[model samples]
Structures are given as structure tokens and as C-alpha cells.
Target: MDPYGDTLFNEQAAQVACQEIAALTLRCADDQRKAALLDLAELLEACETTPGSDVLLMGD
Candidate 1:
């Protein structure tokens, strides 16, 4: 994971990322953070099931 560059996760990594995001979503106390995590988790899940799909994280 690079903080100064973009990160891309393929199907296999998306599955793991989605699960971790879901777990974090459950433990998050802030509603906004939870919502954002949920949205990310949803995207990761979609990427996980779609062939050749990936989740990209752009860093600032």
C-alpha cells in the first residue's frame, strides 16, 4: 500500500479487502465513516465477483 501513489486490487485481493472493510464497518463508531466503509466494501465485493475487475485507491 503506497500513500503517495494509486493502489489497485484484483479479484482475489478485493475479496480480502471487502471482508476487512466489512469488519471495519461493523466496528466503526462514526456514521459517516461507517457509510464510507460500507460503500468501499460494496465496490470491493463487486470487484471480487467480476472477472478482470479491480478496485483502485487513489492517494492524495
Candidate 2:
């Protein structure tokens, strides 16, 4: 989770991230943030199902 670099999560990590994202989405009060989390969760879930695929989080 770097703020100035890139972070990558493999299938196993993506599965865990997806679960955490789902829980965060549920607890989030802001609609915009919740929506973004949901979108990220979807991408993580996709990576979880695709072999060798990873979720690359690019930081600014």
C-alpha cells in the first residue's frame, strides 16, 4: 500500500483484499467512496478467479 509507488496483489491476496473491500464498502458512509470500493472489489474478485492475474494498485 505505497502512496508513491505501485502495489501488486496476486490471486490469494486479491481474494483477501476483495473480502476486506466488501466489509469496508458495507461500513462506508460516503456514497462515492463506497462506490469506488465496490468497483475495486469487483476488480479484485476478477483477479482472484483469473490464474496468474494480479491487481496492480498504482499510486500517485
Candidate 3:
């Protein structure tokens, strides 16, 4: 795959993972897991510092 394609695929995967984490947090009744997923979501948001093409896919 080209660099651009690879970036798109990776970004899609990250978005899917974030969605899954959010769903799990809502479905599961574990406070620790919910907290951890919330933390992960925050960290992922912080890590995305660049305002590139992925920004659109990531909801910004």
C-alpha cells in the first residue's frame, strides 16, 4: 500500500477502536474498564496534534 493508503487505513482502525471502546464502556458495568477506556480516548485525542487529512475522519 502507498503511504497515503496506509495512513487512511490506520486512522480508520483507530476510529473504530475508539468507537468500540466507547460502546464497551457503555455496555459493560465495570468501572475500571470504563475509566481506562475514557482515559484512552483522552490520550488518543491528545496524540492527534496534526491538523491533517485524518482530522476529518476523526471528527474534527
The residue-level lDDT of candidate 2 at 15 comes to: 93
Predicted structure 3: lDDT:
0.58
How many clashes (backbone atoms < 3 Å, residues ≥3 apart in a chain or on different chains) does model 1 have?
A: 0
Q: Find the candidate with the highest TM-score and give its number.
A: 2
Q: In model 2, which residue pairs have backbone atoms overlapping below 3 Å? A: none
Runs in model 1 lying further than 4 Å from the true structure: 1-3
Write down the RMSD of candidate 3 (Cα, Å). Answer: 8.0
Q: 1 or 2, which is superior by lDDT?
A: 2
Per-residue lDDT tens digits for candidate 1, residues 34-58, read 9998888888889988999988888
Selected candidate, larger TM-score, 1 vs 3: 1
Give me the candidate number with maximum lDDT.
Answer: 2
Error of 1 at 25 (Å): 1.3
Q: How good is model 3 by TM-score?
A: 0.51
lDDT of 2 by residue, 1-60 (tens): 466898889999999998899888889999999989988888988999999999888885
TM-scores, each model vs. reference: 0.85, 0.87, 0.51
User: What is candidate 1's local distance difference test score?
Assistant: 0.88
lDDT per residue as tens, model 3, 1-60 = 344433332345556767777878889788888888898766555435433424223321
Q: Which 10 residues in a row give candidate 3 its minimum summed lDDT? A: 51-60
